[model samples]
Target: MMNNGADLEQCKRLIETSLGWGDAATWTNEDFDTLSDRIFEKTSVRLSISTLKRIWGKVRYDSSPTTATLNALARYAGFEGWRDFMATTQPPAKPSPAHEAPPAPQKSPTRRFITPLIIITITFAVLISFISARIIHPPAANLPLRFDHRATSDELPNSVVFDYDATPMHPKTVMIQQAWDPKRREKVDPYGKQHTSIYYYPGYFRSKLIVDGELKMQSDVFIPTKGWKAIIIGDPLPIYLSAAETTLDSGRLSINAATLQAKTGSPVFNSKWTGFFDVHQFAGISGDHFLLRTTVRNTSTVEQCLCRNVSITVMGKLSAIIFPLTDRGCISDIGLYTGFTGVSGKDHDLSAFGCDFSQWQQIVCAQKDQTLDMWLNGRLIYTKPGNRSIGDIVGIRIGFEGTGEIKEATLQGGGVPQDLLKQP
Candidate 1:
């Protein structure tokens, strides 16, 4: 759970990244509605539109979000939970005093004399009160809090049960957090012995039991994947596309535009392409040692627009590599989270991909022992060392903001590099 003002600010940034919005002020009511739908689609948890607006500062609310809300948002952003996101991701650097302007020039003579005299009088009064308080009472002991949790089954959609003990010296509130999302939270009897919750998705989840506003007990829960699944984030509702629906095109797996329109009854712009590769199909091997190569291009010939934006995600058990390609100057709008580095958004320069996107572009991203390296058109584009562990290779997803085509794509596990870009 977040413990300070800085934590709240960081949480807001995490939410913005997850929703693909660069800033809080940029979020609209429609955006919040879409977020509400997306969260339910991905996590099976419902965060009300009003609550989301309040959390994102879109609406005036007197109170901050509950711990449950934070956990849910964190999980949506590819963290074990909110606590994991905060503990692992580094917050933005604070502005240094050296970089700030110096204090204003000294005040006039009469103002200066009066300010010093007032300061001296306050200091004398504070000193006298401090000595009197010390003589009257002694220092107090720290508050005591205890919590422990367990799951009914170490599987997907498992139920987690918690047991906790907290000593409240004063009148304080007590609640249990199932995940970082507020909807997953509930107020429990302060003296109660246990509480339970159900988790629908597979990932590393950090659970917390809170007393008052502070987190008292915490633990992690891991749910393994069963197999590969395809999801189409379409308008009106999301459809679960099946492997049987995909066609093999010159050694690549893709869904045709006519098939997409037939299935969704909508245009390609209303659809979001997402596919997950089950570990079981690849000999059930899971780890950070994996490589993904895919070629994509916009095939839409609509007279109104020629450029189509695309993004590919290498989904690991605990993290993901988001590679976004679009017309020059549009990459900054993409949100990517690497387990090692913190979340990257509009503030980060992603101009490496700002170029013509109509033609097929080859992208290769590899991860060996948590160190991720990427190449575009056989040219090394970026590399970064990871600070955290890459839990497992859950799958990968290819998507287009409007409409696009996939030429070829493959996932390799613990294998020698291949000349993927060789002409077909």
Candidate 2:
């Protein structure tokens, strides 16, 4: 019989193969970061980069992964959970006939089996006791669990106040998670009635109330941007920019490196990013059938930013459609999300999304009949087939590695054009 350690190793190997990113032994820190994002995207559970490194043996650690982490990994590997994966996994093959060992003389069965029998009896008795206890004291039928949230304002750096009541469950611990990322979770007093969390960015967030690791209730918390907001993406908080700070004239929206440096007080732009967001509900626009046309270009030179990457995101109620454009050499560092699933450039041929950033590039994304088609410079680059509708089109976000410009951004469906750049 294979041990739990061997099963875990097999699970890791399967995940690596599914990722199709070559070998885990050669993966870098950035690779692990990307993996972390992908796992969260798929499993809705965020695993810290350090925790992943330890699991992959990239970091030196003695403790094994927790059950929750194993469950997330199993789910990412297309299984229900760790238990399901173990149940369905096949054991190693027996030795071949030529290598088989000779049988030893059989002895009469004796007290040697008594210890195992006693252990089994004890386990059975414990299970029965647990079942009896559960039957005798069942959970509250009408517990009246309530969870809801309201945003304090309509802009970035917004605070959301959550009202919940998990008292009936009598859980030892209560946690309020801002969104899908568990890193945003915070412990709350079970007896308390309110908790507040600040959202530094605008998006459609699903706030959850968890009682003892079990999700008791959840609600949608949509924090829409006032209009076209520019910001330097930062940790814990972002540097917000006013219309005067970002250049929004002559049918163009952009922020230069100087503006970024002034706002962030930093000159280096290796991993820094700037984003333009219009995160409000677009009336009568369905995410399943819409057209987004934009002209974008990276303004930074190679010396300022090596990758010169740009990403366009169409935020939907359920999921978002995200695609990236980068310099030809940095294509391997990008990924695409088609509202249903995400694919990395490392395993897939995403060369079509790569282009020369010295000139303006036209990008068109259209979703119709549950299928998404991407066009670059009038050339079809990718076609993704989706099953379910991603609900209404909520917002649009344009991001740049260092500095970039959007000449035009328009979304249309049923032949009606909605200028995303217009002030609300």
Candidate 3:
């Protein structure tokens, strides 16, 4: 029951294990709050958010231990000390019909094996072999959790997952997909109600339908983690809307798990995401391709984060904010502007027919601060009123390299697919 090294290790281990980490590495109080929130979802522990954060602060650069902190965890774990606690690998059992009554227990001589543990004053100079070990090799219990994992692009034969960047999906009886764009959020009440004002702007070029001439715009795709992966679309729009899945408008793009790992902090070139996916020919673009150019947001928060063991659920309503592209693609490497950059070109090359060359109004969003210049054969045809935006673009492809980072994506209508982000 008294303070000891073993108890400290166990407390550290508890936190680490709860967060799916092998050891209790240095963490600020806020980090612990986030960690506990993640763990509490899967368990029925009545933990106050504030209390866990305080406990985290105790181990985070705490050179001195307080009596109150130790007593709290000891009581919560229903244990006398750290050593006695770490010994419980599984959760204790509950009432069962098989055991109508309990049997008497007896003690053995093995109890003498217990050893006294040492507790050193908090000091950077103290040996931290355990801490180092955790960072180097975390225990198996600490690995992150997953719902599912679909391996190959070929898995979506009959029904599709709407995962990668290709489409014309083999007509499936049913399909599921996951979609969580920050922009797609909406406000709802417990009884199921929503209230919001999220609008998508029109840019200059829609899909191949609006772009007139034969185009092969290359794209720069950014991967959150590097690995070989691909994206695919699953909606039966070709049948329902009688439109090509891809156009100058939107489509899907898939990346590899290996590709994700390799492009850490960088982006890759994906031709499929450059413009629209021709639903008619999309199925034939590539063997198991991945990429989708739907109404997706491409941006990230400037504030860096320190979150782990996190999951979000929306049993009620949600809300989101969307920034449409107007002026230019990007103001800088990370800033935002309307897609309005001016580059001199060889003038209009509108040879292909079914064209409306007179006006090139906004094809994307048309918010108030900026306007974008539509270019064909390098020449500007239409200049929509641009409203400066704060996020990147789902970008239109020209010769210059491009990249995409979804800032906000949401469902406008229809029963949104459920497998949009299911881990495969």
Question: Top TM-score: which candidate number?
Answer: 2
Question: Which ten residues in a row are the worst by lDDT in model 1?
Answer: 276-285
lDDT of 1 by residue, 383-420 (tens): 76653445566556677654556777778775225673
Q: Which is better, 1 or 3, measured by TM-score?
A: 1
Question: What lDDT does each candidate get?
Answer: 0.63, 0.84, 0.28
Q: Give lDDT tens digits, candidate 3, residues 1-424.
A: 4344555656656656645644334554435544553333223233454556545455254443454455445434445533456455336677688876777566455543432222333343355776776667566355531112222222112121111211111111111112222222222221221122211111211111001111112121121211112222112211111123222243333222233323333333322122211111122222111122223322221121111000111110111112123213221211122222211112322222112212221122222224423222223333435322323222222110122222222212112123322323
Write down the worst ten-residue block by lDDT for model 3: 307-316
Q: By lDDT, rank the candidates, best first.
A: 2, 1, 3
Best by lDDT: 2
Candidate 2 lDDT over 268-370, as tens digits, reads 6778899999998999898878888999999988888899899999998887889799999998999998775667897888999998998899988888777
lDDT of 2 at 206: 80
Which parts of model 2 have CA positions greater than 4 angstroms off?
1-139, 414-424
Candidate 1 accuracy as TM-score: 0.49
Root-mean-square deviation of Cα positions for candidate 2 versus the true structure, in angstroms = 10.4
Candidate 3, residue 386: the lDDT equals 33
